[model samples]
Target: MDSGQISIGQIRRSEHLPARIAAQLAAQITEGHLKPGERLPTEHSLSKTLGVSRSVVREAIAQLRNEGLVETRQGVGAFVSEKCARPIRIKDEELGDPQSFRALFQLRVPLEIEAAGLAALHHTAEDLARIDEALAGMTGAEKWTHQGVEADLLFHRAVAEATQNEYFAMFVGFIAERISHAIDAARARAVLEEIVEVTIAEHVVLRDAIASRDPKRARQAMRTHLLGAASRINLSLEEF
Candidate 1:
């Protein structure tokens, strides 16, 4: 592998294309395959090499820059930052571990609980519409499919957005993205029809609470939904 030269096989097609690409390049940089101050392959070069669009490559590079892993100069391409102090992050692969998954859930619960409360207090009609749309998506999706998982994520994001706090939205989005694969895995293990029905019902309750503009009710509803999710995943929160 030439200095920042990635092969087509290195990239995977998914809804999170930019993130997946960023993770791959970040691994290379941290593993020393790409040296400090070395220029990354140009966006055009990376696009062709990885068989992805320039926009995808640009977004991946932007993520790296945000993490202090890369730098860019005007009229020049991006280069690995000399002092690449990568920020704290939960690697996607680590979520497969039960302990890591549980820890992530622990972190998620309080943030989302507050988010639900704030959303109830602050949500606009448009916010409610987004939540409803996501709910409808989940309600209509086929059992145990990625579509359902994505819709579930969107619903949480909608709630986060309804809080009208950008940081709340950002962190909630991050946590939701991290737990997505775990949710998918749990869905696979669960009894399909039962899980689908149960999960949808919980979301509906949460949505109604939010729509009703009752912060207390919304917080409780979110808590119940998250705990129910943990149970479906075979995790005992009592042990934590």
Candidate 2:
């Protein structure tokens, strides 16, 4: 692509613009449009060409650096890494689409299963109460409602928090927020009543297992709930 064709396009307020921009440039590197050791455009020039701020351009470059997609010298700008590229993260919006439901759940399963096991091993009385509060929020809410969705996210986050690992809490919070729309899309495709009912039962089982301090049961319960969610979304594991 030429400099003339470099616009990054209109960005949504809620989306992380720098991450989107970084993903775009990384694709260029992976696809060979940007050759290894070739200097990137100056941040100021990128800001002008992409119609984003200089800070956004800088952050995009920084993200690529962190991902090992690019390298920088103190006086020089960025260059594509000489090493073969790893698979880039699918953009959150893309992953959260109903069509990508299986992929989404596949990403969730391992992390959340470990989170559940740790929560079972580590949860205190207050942590248990927080989990129950989130459950109560869902119980009082109707299916497909915003309140219910938020409650559901909180339940997962509470479990992460119960693990007593700050990184787990942060990562779970990010995943929960990103997956909300996908979860809604899944519900839209299926029987909302059945989705709600089954979700409640699954959450209760997982929560009870955690509260009982059964790591094995907590892991199994979480796995069952996520797999069941994929089914509710009409996704087969084979799709992943």
Candidate 3:
């Protein structure tokens, strides 16, 4: 091979290697392989171990720093930030009380309702395609599980992405797991089966409203759907 020419494989591998290494290190932090406040290895050491260039290691560290996972001291090495290792835990005690859960639902309703409305106005064709794909997944009744819950969440996430707002997308992703947990908990109660059906049907309505670009209808439908869910969950909680 000529020194002036780049191999296709080299280019492809170069593109992927740094990100792969960064992600692996990040997983170590998030998964507790690297404890909070532990210093990272020097760039030279990390590069040798990961089989990447020193520049690649440096860039990876920069990315982690941006995510608040690591920090640097000018004369010293990089250290794991305390914020990086902890997972956000929504405790059983939080859900044990009806009032707290209701309050949570109250806060969630408006954020999503507004997001849906904005999505109807701003969604791209590709975003619509993603939404449709998730909807199709949900229609397969035999396949509904935690994965199904995720697909359902993805449909809403697609809408948030469609809104062309970064903060909305980030906020939606942040709440996605918590909302899924709460819904899954509620759904486990046999009394909430009807509520599940209603919820899926409302997703259909919400999807159609957004597809039609009817922002007002989309927002109102989402709000109504969520409020209805709150009511049913509350009723089941009362029984519990």
Best by lDDT: 1
Task: Note the residue pairs that clash in candidate 2.
Answer: none
Per-model TM-score versus the true fold? 0.72, 0.60, 0.60
Which of 1 and 3 is the better model by lDDT? Answer: 1
Which residues of candidate 2, in runs, are more than 4 Å off?
1-92, 96-101, 238-240
Cα-based RMSD of the predictions, in order?
A: 5.5, 8.5, 12.2
Per-residue alpha-carbon lDDT of candidate 3 for residues 84-174, written as tens digits (9 for 90 to 100): 3433434335755777666656666777889999999999999999989888776667324655666776777788888999667656644
Each model's lDDT: 0.81, 0.77, 0.69
Task: For model 1, name the residue pairs that clash.
Answer: none
The sequence of per-residue lDDT tens digits that candidate 2 reaches over residues 10-48 is: 556566666678778877777777878877888877877
- Structural RMSD, model 1: 5.5
Question: Where in model 3 is the C-alpha error above 4 Å?
Answer: 1-98, 191-193, 235-240
Residue 80, candidate 3: alpha-carbon lDDT: 82
Number of clashes in every candidate structure? 0, 0, 0
Over 4 Å off, model 1: 1-8, 12-19, 25-87, 141-144, 238-240
TM-score of 2: 0.60
Per-residue lDDT for 227 in model 1?
Answer: 92
Ranking by lDDT: 1, 2, 3
Model 2, residue 16: distance off in Å is: 14
